[model samples]
Target: MSFDSANLERAAAWLAQIARQRLTARAGQLVETDLGAFDYYEDGSWLAHLLRRHQPSGEEFGILMLALSPHICPHLLDTVIAEVRPEGGELPELGGVRAAGHRAMLPTGETAQFFFSGMNMSRRFDIEGMFLADHWFARDRILWLESVREGEPLMSGRLIVNPEIIEELVTGKIGRPAFSMDFPAEHIETAMDWDDLVLNPLTRAQIREIEHWVKHNDTLMDDWGMRKRVKPGYRALFYGPPGTGKTLTAMLLGKHTGKDVFRVDLSRVVSKYIGETEKNLSRLFDKAENKNWILFFDEADALFSKRTDVRDAHDKYANQEVAYLLQRIEGYNGLVILASNQRANIDDAFVRRLQAIIPFPMPQQEERYEIWRRTFPEQIALAGDVDWRQIAARHELTGANILNVTHFCAIEALAKQTREVDLRCLEEAIKREYVKEGRVM
Candidate 1:
């Protein structure tokens, strides 16, 4: 049978059995109760028909599954279906099952007090309830339900299952939460390595440490329990001037370690509302917790700046935000790189929490020469008049600046209808870059 058909049959059979048992028990008839044979509907075949009938869109089903899987269980789902599907009715209500108590007559001749009791015994009981209560489930707004009525011991809310959950259950793959303002791996896969990066001794050592941490993270934390004694995460600071390769280094670290680099957009994270920033950050950290992604905060001074005296409400809230960030940073077991233009701009207290603080200084003349030479594509012919030493010495540019100059020179050479990048073109490009920076060439 095909995937959908198979699941549909399984769901129909499972639900039919549940419905028969439910009806028989209601009529005070003997019900077979062997739960060993009735395996937990692991494949989510039980909801396949209901989902197909209600939500025909496949993409919608996938999305709903991504959001609901973390908060749903098979027994709860079965109970929900049983409550809505009447004995001889048409389609059941798609809104959700009412949180009314429904007894499950087990196949082993044992009575489960409530259908939800079976759900409670699966994996982690009431864990989803805690997650739902704390997090804003309404934000996804896929699973809408009524508020629990007073004196109702059972949860009275409606449990609207999204098509995504059904799809996931059928496929057996739980999707990650769709978090806003966080870049995923696919977004940064095309990031180029800094071939011209001139790493000093200290920087090299720090990079090694980061690599070791990533490789042996589980051993140190789980096997050794070092994480329990100290902060679980490796926090580092990349402080340097613009165009000095801080951002590139972070990306390279992620690439080398086979981890995704999520560059946090501080503009989106730091909000004007009091608690909103924390809420946004909480969502980010929570989603990224177990996912081995390196959290890269570029231009981190904006958020990690020194705490000021509380002259007003803004200052107090700002400090509170910093404190909350510190807590989250300490709790995270993965790698987090905070890139800042100036180390002084970052808080002293925050700096104390770091495992490494590698400074990215401006490339020296020799390094600059290397950068200029390496950055120039071998495909592009260099004119005999083009002087690498003169260019590198005269214009003390960062690796990034050198790249920009090379690109402009190439384009200029192309525009002039020449394959060779001549001295005039290179000089003019370098001069233009300096001029753009508000500096006299």
Candidate 2:
């Protein structure tokens, strides 16, 4: 028979065993069957097949069986069988007449509760539940369950695994749960490298330090127990003028480390409602924890601004939001880079907590020339008269502005139907950029 058929048959057999045990217990008679023998693999049973497929080491089969416990429970198995075979028929025979029912009959009140809590008592199968519970507390898994709001005593909550896990089981490929549901940030595709970044010696060294920290993070945090002594994360502040390479540096760090970069959109994070900002940030951090992700907070001054005096309710709540963020950042066991144009605007409390504060200074004349030289592709034809040194000296522009002028000049050359970019085109591009910025050029 097919895998599905075999799996369902095995599930039915397990449920039948549960029914027999329950009936025997209700009758107050001494059960004679060797329940321990049932744990062994039958010749053509699903456990035997799984053992062949996985070839796990000692006790792994027991763990896998425990993980499958909830699925093989009488209620869920009956529900699945009923849905599959609507035109009901007797369950496949295992041994006793008690196991011949078309559907598992629901036990009344206390007995019904016993099915979920006591079904595994004989096997002492509590390890899987304990493992999952520990992971939930460690923030490795999110638990969603129904609970009473306020002081009311509602029905007891049951652990509901997320849909991603359910999908993995159905596909027979169990893996880590993907946080697609209620994830608040967007993943950024970083396409930068060392060659694309232009900064001073100190800034470059600082960037290299950040990369090194990420590379040996596990050793420093786990092996050395630094997570317990110090903060469990690396928080760096990239501060400089607009158009300096702060954002690019953050992206390059993520690319070099092979980690996904998520630029947190402050617009979405800073909610108008009370306590909403904390909720949003908590969700983002919970989803990102242990996921090998780099959290990039660009234009961070808005979110990390200095806390104002409590003149009103807005001011008080705003400080509370900042406090919440401070706690979350400290607790995160990953990389977080916050970029801001003005470093002075950031709160002193945050600055004190940061591991590194690297300032991205505007490019000097020599650096600007390097940026211009490297900006164009080798395939692009440039006029012999295009003087990089003169242009770098004439315009007090950031690296970003220089790139804009280069692009504009190339497009201008293309419009003029020329294969070569000339000095005049470069000058015109620079002039246009200055005009856009309202500079006296």
What TM-score against the true fold does each predicted structure earn? 0.71, 0.74
Error of 1 at 421 (Å): 2.0
For 60-176, candidate 1 gives per-residue lDDT tens digits of 332233224324333543454456554534222111332335432111101111221222234123323422544333333334334456884333343454445455545554454
Runs in model 1 deviating more than 4 A are 1-113, 118-154, 157-186, 194-196
Best by lDDT: 2
Model 2, span 263-321: residue lDDT tens: 88888888899999999898888777767788999999878999999999999999999
Q: Estimate every model's Cα lDDT from 0 to 1.
A: 0.64, 0.66
